[model samples]
Target: MYESVLVATDGSDSADRAVDAALDLASVFDATLYAVSVVDTRRYGDSALSGTEDIVSDLETQANELLDAVEKRADGGVMTELRHGKPHAEISDYATAIDADLLVLGNRGRESGEVIGSTAERIVRFVDRPVLTI
Candidate 1:
C-alpha cells in the first residue's frame, strides 16, 4: 500500500538489514525507495575547533559511502540522501518532506544497544508516518 518508502541507515549491520527489508517492501509495492544517511552534527561542539572541519568532512564522506552502498545494493533502484544535523531530527524531517508512506530503519544504529537506537525511537514516537524497525 505504500507509494514511497524511506530508510535511514548508519552503515551498521542492523541498518543493512533494514535496507534489505526496505528494498523488499518497496519492490513488493512498486514504491519509490529512499535511502538516507545522516551526519550527526551534534557530535561536534557549538564552535568549530581546529580539527572540527576534518571530523565533519570525514563524517560526510562516511555518509556518502553508506548511501552509495545502499544504492549499489538496491541496483540503482533507490534514491539516496546525505543529511546533516541530529540523526532523529533530520530523518524525521526528511520523511515528512518526502511525504513518505512508510519509514524503515534499524532498531539499533551504530551507537546504541540492540534493543532500540535513540534515533529510531525518536522517529517512531515523533514522526507521523508508519515506522518499521528491523
Candidate 2:
C-alpha cells in the first residue's frame, strides 16, 4: 500500500487524467497526496537575461493555479509544491524529497502530444521510484 503519492502536472488534460488516477490510488490506500508543477527554466531559448524574470513569474503563477486545482480535485489531504527547473528532474527530486511511495505522471505533457514527453521519459528512466504513467 502506498503511504505517499506524488503527481506531476503541467496543467494539461492528460495530466488531469494522471491526477485523477493518483487521487484514486491515494484515496484507496489512505495515502498522502502531493501535487507538483515545475516551471521549465529553459524558456527564452537564448539570452537568459532578457525578460526571464517576467517569464518565470508568469509561469509560476500559472503553475500554482494548476496545483491549486489539482488539490481541489483530491478527496484527501494534499500538499502542493511549485518548482523551477527541468520538469523531470524537479519531479523526481520532489518524490525523493518527500520519500514518496509512488510517482504518478501522464505519458505526455502540455508540450508534447502523440509522443511521450521527454520529462516522463527521463523520470521513468532516472528516478528510483515506482512510476505509474497514465
Query: Evaluated with TM-score, which candidate comes out highest?
Result: 1
Give TM per candidate: 0.94, 0.92
RMSD of 2: 1.6
lDDT of 1 at 67: 94
The whole-model lDDT of each prediction reads: 0.90, 0.88
The reply for model 1, stretches above 4 Å from the true place, is 48-51
Q: Which stretches of candidate 2 lie above 4 Å from their native place?
A: 46-50
Per-residue CA lDDT of candidate 1, range 32-104, in tens? 9999999887776657634578888898999999999989888999989999889899999899899999999
What TM-score does prediction 2 earn? 0.92
User: What's the residue-level lDDT of 106 in candidate 1?
Assistant: 94
Task: Give per-residue lDDT, candidate 2, residue 47.
Answer: 72
